[model samples]
Target chain A: MSPFLLLLRLRLMEVFRVRFTGFFFLGLPLLFFALVGVIFSSGHPFAHRRVVMVATAADENRSSEMLVAMARFTEIRVERAATHEAAMGKLRAQIVNAVVEPLSDGSGYRLIVGGFDELFGRGLVTALPGHVELAVAPLERWGFVHYAFAGMLVFCVAISGLFGMGYNMVRYRQNLFLRKLSTTRLSKSTFVAAQIAGRGIWSLVQVLLLLALAHLLFSLPLSLVAALWTLGLTVLGLCAFLGIGFLLACFIRTEGLIYDAISSIAWPIVLLSEFFFPADELPSPLRFAAAALPSTQLVRLLRAVLLYGETDVASLLPGIAIILVWIVMTFTMGRFFFRWND
Target chain B: MGFGDQDALLLKVVIAAARLTKRFGSVVALENVSFQIEGPQLICILGPNGAGKTTLLDLLEGLSQPDAGEIRLFGTPLSARRYPRERVGVVLQKEFILDGITVGEYAELFATIQGVKGAQQILSQARLQDRAKTPLSKISNGESQRLFIAAAAVHHPELLFLDEPTAHLDPGAKLEVGRLLTEMSSEHTVVMTTHDLREADTLSDHVLFLVDGKLKAEGAPATLIDSIPPAARGHGTLEEAFFHFCAARLTARGDIEPVRP
Candidate 1:
């Protein structure tokens, strides 16, 4: 093996030997999710593809906005028809769960639900319009699982990177192991690379395991592309947080302080992110603050693609850009200040 | 294969330091020190506590830059951010060994990064072959130091720096380390710092005596013995030499007023 790879292997072997490492990645998040499920007990019981058809006579621009709003529900799949008769053909054939028709008074589009899921579709009709909270009505048992699973993922990414890479590295510095390594033919860059690369590989396994558990234990729907999106967003978030941890290790002289610092930084991030509540639903400035936080955007973007079926590159730009900047900024600052205290 | 460019191997000179000075905050650790070592032989830097012995080693190993002055290793300009790690090896006074890793893994990590092979052989040479699978946390302190020396020398460095490598060991372990260093000196030019009078007198082919950040005396053992003032004659050679200069330095300081330094 190459020096970097060899070092990375040893680092992984060393870190895994620590008690509760696997549990930290796998069990803790599931436990947190179960806690969330109990707190928010209300849910939509029958989650499946909720295909909605649109009548041609419906108001054009308003209907488009309404479709966008409705699509936020993971179960909703919107389709369009040329005429009312054509829409009814699909609805009668059971291809569409429901169709949106223009109400007699014309205040807004009205739900004309029917199909194999007629009774459940009828419940959505009464729950439509001003009461859009029912958008998650189909999610039923899956609601808290999705929301809390995403929360735990973001939490895990931050904790693993900060504690796993950062705190451990500071301990190495305090023990003078880094100083000893500095005397060998090992360059500082190689050592840092080994640490980052090692943790990065571990992050991959962690994400895959979490996603798999979500599928196996909770029966959360898992599509390959959604799985890929969650993994990509999670690892990107891990890299950014890892940089923060690296930055901490670079300057902090003691392990206890590093531990305290990591906890201080990580907890606030989880609180302000979509971990606890929906950032977009909050008041403007609070929402704006949460929206700007990389942690919030990371979970937000992951949830968008994983649950809501959002695929637009433009929508994910803010979170991806914030995380990328974090990667560059933290690593750069960390490198600038980092030195062996020989 | 190397962290630093080992271009200095082409040059014949082992080390050439001129007027090296170093400071930490307001405290000057080394001041205007100059010396040169020319061949594959053991050289001892003898000093008391706070005498700038480690600071000198730090400069020569390129671990730190002199606040003023220059140093060359094997005829190349030494760097403050030391590189070309293949040419120089350092074994610090206190062993820096990581827990959780076995002795073999520890040795292999250093040897591989130094771009050398046969880590097992290196461990065998250090007498750590039996303990190869033992975790570093479980090893005796003396064994750890010996392993460091063994691992650092795997690359067969042109210049080796030891900072009080035998400081805290028992007499038997100390002798064992002293013997390892003696063997190292025959293959490479080794610079060691020590306060142990017996170890210095036994191991050093040449001696550089330092006192309070200044070079006080430097020469072959016989030459240093001859230079001892007549009043200090037959005071036990090197031990007498240390006391003779230390006594002179102490007497000289008596005329100066005390200052917080």
Candidate 2:
């Protein structure tokens, strides 16, 4: 075999052999998606209300069915408030979590959660006026798990490139495998290219497997266009993350230090980027910083394409440009500071 | 000497360096060091710890560059793009393993890298074919050392650089590797570093003695012995001669006063 091809094959084989690579880079993403998917898809009808005030009518028998239905929620504490102003006073005093006003037309109770800030307030408002007959939507068209799944895919891409390609470089350097290779006729560029190619192929496989499983299990709206978009974004994400990994590996001297350093950088960016929840509620500067992270852009592009079926290539230019800028910057730094011995 | 003899000498000189100097921050690793090696000889570089022995090998093997010097391998300048890499091999002091790879797989990887087809033969010569299928983690330190030799020699490099290759091995393993290296020295020029004076006496045809990043002496073992004073010889054999050189440098620098009779 050609030397580059041999190197690529050996690299991929080594990645497959190491249990850590298999577990974290490839398997963990699918596992997280499944767990998060089930949890998010299992929505409850009365989950939106935790505490509510009932404005009982003069007869008190008009809304007996509604009161009984509200009473069914074990987590919610429902009490009788005489008037809307009294309910507002209770909410301001932090006494009652929300107020449920009786509708004049007897359609259903109107939920009035004051100072709509907390999730409880939002939930109450979302399920108001139809509390007796309302059922929680089975799954959101672009629900919590859908957002989480996008982030997970991008995170998998980053981890695979960082650990699979970057960590391997550090290991090879530490063990003097790189020095040994240096003495051979194999050019360093060829060796590095082989590394990138092996990781790229593995990431492609991961994308295929993740999309196929998601389509089969959760009925994710996976189309040929979505697959293509995901594949493209994954490739770009791998390049950016692999560059970051190389940048870290170029300076970090030990296996332990590399893990800590990668986690410190990756976790913060992932968390602050509104990966698990919405970042729009975050402070302005923090939200701006999160948007600047390449990973954040990757997740956004992926979510846009997958959930919303956004096909406009022009709309994605800014994200692509951000990711590309990161790729160039990190790749340059990694190469500039790289030392075979260290 | 005749012109033909001069031609033979020119052809025999496989490695030559002139005024090589290397520094690591404030510390000088090698200073104005120069040497030449002709083919088919085992040269042992003897030095104290931190004596720039490994640094010299690293520069010679093209693993590093000198601060201000030039090296020629096979009569080509080291800076040349076509410097002969396939004709050289190196075994570092530390035992580096590919972790999950088997001995055979490791050998094959290097063989392929160097464009050689002698993985089996190299493993057999190192007497490691029996353990070829075993993972590197499962192999003994001695077996791993032998594998290093086999991998380094798989392409039959004309010049081999070994940095303290047997310093950590058991006595038996050392002897075994010594025998293998001795056999290899019949065709390939081997350069190695060792703290063991006896191992050097046994394996080397020439000795390059170093002390504190400086080449204190270079020649056959007998030549270095001859340089020792008659009185110093009475203190011991080769060990006394080595000390004589180190003390000579110290005394010359006025670090220690000479003893009076």
In the range B70-189, model 1's lDDT, one tens digit per residue, is 787777777766456788889876666676899999889888888878698679878999998999889877888888888878888877889998877899999898899899889988
Per-prediction tally of clashes: 3, 0
Tens-place lDDT digits, model 1, residues A234-273: 8788888888898888867777667757866775576568
lDDT of 2 by residue, A78-114 (tens): 6665455545434443334566666677766655554
Candidate 1 C-alpha error for residue A183, in Å: 1.4
TM-score of each: 0.77, 0.70
Best by TM-score: 1
**What are the Cα lDDT values of the candidates?**
0.74, 0.74
- The residue-level lDDT of candidate 1 at A223 comes to 81
- For all candidates, state DockQ relative to the true structure: 0.52, 0.46
